[model samples]
Target: MTKQELKEYYWIRRNITKSEQRLIELETAATKITAQLKNKHDAIMGQGNTSDKVGNTVADMELVRDEMTEQIKRSYAVLAKLEKAIEELPAREGYLIRSRYIELLSWEQIAVDMNYSWKQIHRIHAEALHQLQ
Candidate 1:
């Protein structure tokens, strides 16, 4: 692969990974909020409920919600960076990298489609990183 291809591949991989991780983090936060909500419901049903407990749960859920919103914003930022990086990549490399990384294709599939050896694809990806720097 060419240096341009390598750079495109690296940037695409980075963005995809970042976006995916952010999504996971967002999900985790949502899960925590759900758990807190359930706890709050239980607390309400139970005797000896206090305003302090309810207020604390609401606050925690709000904090988690806010954090999830932030994570979503981060995901959008990653996507934007990915878009800019794609635009900067050489045409051929951009197509291949986007197809393989963003679309999440396996190396064998990308190789077969591109008529490139696996080693060649790896080299292209590596060189792309070097060229990027």
Candidate 2:
């Protein structure tokens, strides 16, 4: 993989996390909307039509939910591919890549965890990227 492709692992992971969070938020909103709609229906039962508003809201939410779900699926596919590639590397290389991208660890933290000097960690990271290619 090129550097850009390798770098995308971090983005894909981030997107997955954000998408999942958004899904939770959407679910909460949907529940609240449902409750509100029920109350509105009871209040305005024969006075006016609520179907249009309810239909529009439900359609919009479903569109957003479907889009987010697809994004999450695609992100997971990329993440799985990246993870498999990382797993194929040597132990140290795999660790470096996983730590930096998947675990979102800082270089210093990775160096400390790996018991290597900062400069040495960079060197290892370079080698890991090369192996990834």
Candidate 3:
């Protein structure tokens, strides 16, 4: 994996998290809309008019939620591959890679966690990237 490929791992993980949140929001909105549709049906029954608008809105939300679900699955697949590559590295390199990319930890935090100086952390990060490649 090149630097860009490693960076992609981070972005993919972030996208998955965002997509999941959006999915939850979509589901909540759909539930609210369904509830409104039910109330409208009860109040407007036999009026010769139905809530086609609300129905369509719920359908659109479902479509978007399904698309987001598929995208999240694909992102997880890619992330798993990237993680496997990182796991193949030596223990220190793997830890450094996971800390920086997967966990989104700052370099200083990683240095503190590993009990290394800032400069030393950078050096290890460089070596870890090389190993990934």
The 10-residue segment with the lowest total lDDT in model 3: 42-51
Clashing residue pairs for model 1: 6-128, 7-128
Model 2: lDDT equals 0.84
Residue 74 error, candidate 1, Å:
2.0
RMSD value for candidate 1: 6.7
Q: Work out the TM-score per prediction.
A: 0.53, 0.79, 0.77
CA-RMSD of model 3: 2.6
For residues 6-75, write the lDDT of model 3, one tens digit per residue: 8788788788889999999999999998987777786656554466767778999999999999999999
- 51-83: candidate 2 lDDT, tens digit per residue: 567757877998999999998998888778887
> Which residue pairs come into collision in candidate 2?
1-133
lDDT of 3: 0.86
Per-residue CA lDDT of model 1 for 2-119, tens digit only, reads: 3344335455556656756765675676577667656777665664656456556657756765675676566566567666776677766666676666676887887888889998
Off by over 4 Å in 3: 45-50, 105-124
